[model samples]
Target: MLRQLRGWSYMYEKIFDGIREQAHVRDELRMGLVCDACDLGPCTFDGSTSRVPCGITPDEMAMKNLAEKIAEGLGEYKTHKRHITMVYDMESLLEAATRMVDVSRSYSDEIDKLLSPYRTVRTVPFGLGGLRPEAVNICAVSSPRGIHDLIEFTRTPEAAENIECAGAHGVNIVSLGYPGAELAYQRGIPCIGNYLVLDNALATGCIDAIHTFGSERASLEEALKHFASRKGPQCELPEPKMHTTGATLDVTAINRAYERGNIEGVVVLFGAASPTCSWHMEGLVTDLVEHGYLVLVTGAHMYEGSTDAMNAPGVVHIGFCEIGKMHGKGFAPTPFVLVPGWKNAKILTSTLALVHHGYPVITGVRIPLTPSIEEKLAEKGCITELNGERVVERISELQSHREG
Candidate 1:
């Protein structure tokens, strides 16, 4: 109930009731990203303009957007972790994609080694119920780098004095994506909500500010003073509910079940936390599991569900989006992926890099034009379907082939 953005509390009921239904500025993303970087034309390349004053065709613009997103995620690693890699560009899209596939594996291995001891899961509180009306609420809308210090220091008493200064009152990791999951695993730092729940989270009239790293920034001091004095009925938070990560699920049991004809092929699920996408993804899991395939869930999609899904008979909740990326680059025997939406820049670019590697994907996003690299993948190359119905058919057909 805490996750619901609907009318849970009569006091702050309308704060986020009608936001999602609002009309979007653009009709649809033609291929890559909608260009709003300049004043010339905020175009979707809907065949309205022949030549964009931005000096790039729709194809070129898509390629550029893809490269930028990959660089953005990797660049963060460089800044905080001191990780370095050879940087390449526009014409070198294919080479860059190959490098991303290779380097990301190394990064996965490194992070695993550094934090291996904290892998096994346990039960943790899920909703806004744990929130105290008196204490300040600061959501950590953070990245791996941003949340690194708090998790690192809080391990011991002496080191914790540093982070215990401002964040000592009340703090919860809001939607830090993959890093948030990692933080939850390392120490049971409660992650209240993902990207979808941001609006209602702040609207609770008690959330003081956000501790930003990526897109969401913390509130300023002057603004916070008014927050305490602001007039409104504070919504009463529910009693905390228990959610488990491990949830008594095992991967080897899945592999053995596959051998025993109890399960068919394995499918890995990930991507952005769109409510529509998540609902469909959950449905896909239900359909796939019923079809006798073990569905491995991850990213925001995994967290958005009840423990019943996480602990489902044929469903295994993998670590986070890193597993999703690893699955993209033909991890051992490659598995099929369903990326329903790419609203986030990182996911969009990550999808580009995966497709550039010539891996076949079943996504609802329409690239409009295939890249030169995907062109090399040929008849069976990167498939970007726009219709959701056809996406299901494509996966069903592919699953049947795997069965055969």
Candidate 2:
């Protein structure tokens, strides 16, 4: 459906984050599991159990795939820039799926213990500034790793020589998504937005050269070092509902408001893109609030389809998935919960973490990982089916116990 993100990657002889944006949308929902475990076939199926030539069932393939996604999610911390003592045997999920171990304790304990330090309320400044007009702009998008990569390379003499050649006052850097509020605490590098706004930041025409530094993509050096001016018109970003804007999960505020019946409960959009297929972004959020749940549309979902949605009374645009969504996870035992769309790897980490904490994560997919895990999650919350009505019904049911 999203035909062209950035139309001139070839013109610059350099690829940008637009490619990843397109793939994120494609693989998360549209493409199901594919088993290339055997050379006989890279057979694709709709997460079914029809056995392949390699004797691996789709059920088995799904478990392996799920484990792999968790591993990739954990890799986000490798360059985490801080020490992490907590450990999760994520393979335990696969083991439990196969009945090797009774689903052990949720990973939420470990993740929460680790993230406890980053929980303080903070403002993450976004929207294209902090660049020296005379200097070259070294822009990067993708994983948190890409931010690190941009930092490391921009220091080398090789980079210095290039900026000197351009007669600029050193390179001005911009990092996207990670290290915004939680991880890095707003270093000089200003983050434009989450993964969803990668292309949007590029289209702003303020950035100079884009880099995929933290990416293992080949020839990143060329991209980091190259400058490609836009031949097309820059896109206009709409004014935000608030200026000097900030969004953070205030546990005390939420509880006080709920007790007074200001909100029935909380609904967090965990790495979900909206407006979803069946619902407009604002419509879904407005519906949730009307049902008495305060809706926190988080991460890329905040900007995926913006149209004064955040301006709605109950909606809060918490910046970046890792920071905002993790706060939502902290509410596991308290009843403030996260609602996730099984979108991507970062989302997989957040969703599984919440599931570990015993939140009944409602997703449209009937069988996301395995029937067993889905079944157990369903026990906590109903599996949403058909349209936004199911989700609204679930919200009503969850908040029904509040008695306010």
Candidate 3:
């Protein structure tokens, strides 16, 4: 599995590694102070300097930097959400609502209630011109309901896991964001995340078809058209679904996962990958799930045998953005593990957010940290390694703390 993924991920791994190396070098060169008021000189953080010229402490600077990264992640998700809502039509919306009713009715009354307004509406205008070519395809990938329905709808033998369809020809599945990528993968379509990773995936000479959601459709289509005209190399389609492996968890499913005695706790995993890392991550998740931990995964790791992991009976796949939504709805107080990928500033900031919110998190990958940052996180009782005994002990401590 690692070998195959390595082949697919080579281009992406190089790109990510290069960026991280460049950033690390830049950080090393920085004096680490930038005045908020004037974007002033990078003042040294040596012992001689108690504060930057702006009177900001090292702690303050760290917090500000973290805040900026968090804000950037928030902004990206907001934009994706906006695109999804803006492009969905009433008819497609109704179909999605109906499918939700069909597949999840037994488990969720909230979905029914939430979608009630859309049920009575009819004939929604095609709001975007790009949607006309294959409006259902666009809608199916964009909206939440559409995404859910598409996965359920595609889970048939006739559709197969990797069927060769006219529509899929010369196209690569450039899945936009978290849940979308997870859904596409379950349907036997290979997917890459949005942003820089998405660009690298397209450049790999493997994807001719662009299976994406939200505003990404336009850009991907433009790229695909260019590739098609030039007779570029095409990637082989992923194998069809031989079995139902992954289960998508919404708010209700998440709540139920907790309610059931089967789930000991929940752990959220995040990262992009090299094939080796992907393999190690999967092994770690499998071990955790076997021990009765309900693992909730997002980001690039979602494509790493996530569905197969669900066969362990304790793994629930979710979108990266959905983690905060779940956490916001009184879920933060729950003791869970946050295993972040190494070296990514975005993941680090997210880990910081989880730690700040008082969650017991254990890092799955080694965090690139300064001594100060490491000391601070340690003082807060955040685990920076994937030691099983340590994680269990920390979780017990957090649980006791909450109970008290």
Candidate 1 lDDT, 1-404, residue by residue in tens:
66564545653655444444433433436366467432233556665656664456777778867786697678767543432334333335433444455566676666555655655666555446534455445566666545655444334455234224434433343333566555544445555545555566666765665666542222334224534564423556767655556433344554565556666556666554443342355466667766665566555434333332422336554445653335433233245666666545445556556656544566654443448634543244445555554655677676566457
List candidate 3 stretches off by more than 4 Å.
1-173, 176-190, 193-200, 208-260, 271-279, 303-312, 330-335, 342-344, 366-373, 386-404
Candidate 3 on 1-404: residue-level lDDT in tens?
99989887997899888888877445523543433322133344555556553456776766666676576578557544443335434333223223222222232334333333333211111111111122112223354444544444344454332333434332223244543434433443333443334444444444334433434434344444544453332333233222222343444444565576546566666544322132355466666666666666655334233443322345444433333433444442264755544323334555555565556767654554477766666666566655544554566566676568
Better of 1 and 3 by TM-score: 1
Give the winner by TM-score.
1
Instruction: Name the lDDT value of residue 92 in candidate 2.
Output: 49
Q: Encode model 2's per-residue lDDT on 1-404: one tens digit a residue.
A: 23353445454444455566567445533433675432234455543435554455656667767776676468556533322223334444422222211121233333334444444433334444433345566556544444545555677787777657655567666665543322223233455544455565666654666665344233234433443333222324444321121444466666667667676666666544322335344566667777666666544334322222222336665544542244333442244344434434344444555555545456543334366755655664435453755667765665564344
Better of 1 and 3 by lDDT: 1
In terms of lDDT, the best-performing candidate is: 1
Q: Residue 47 in model 3: shift from native, Å?
A: 28
Better lDDT candidate (2, 3)? 2
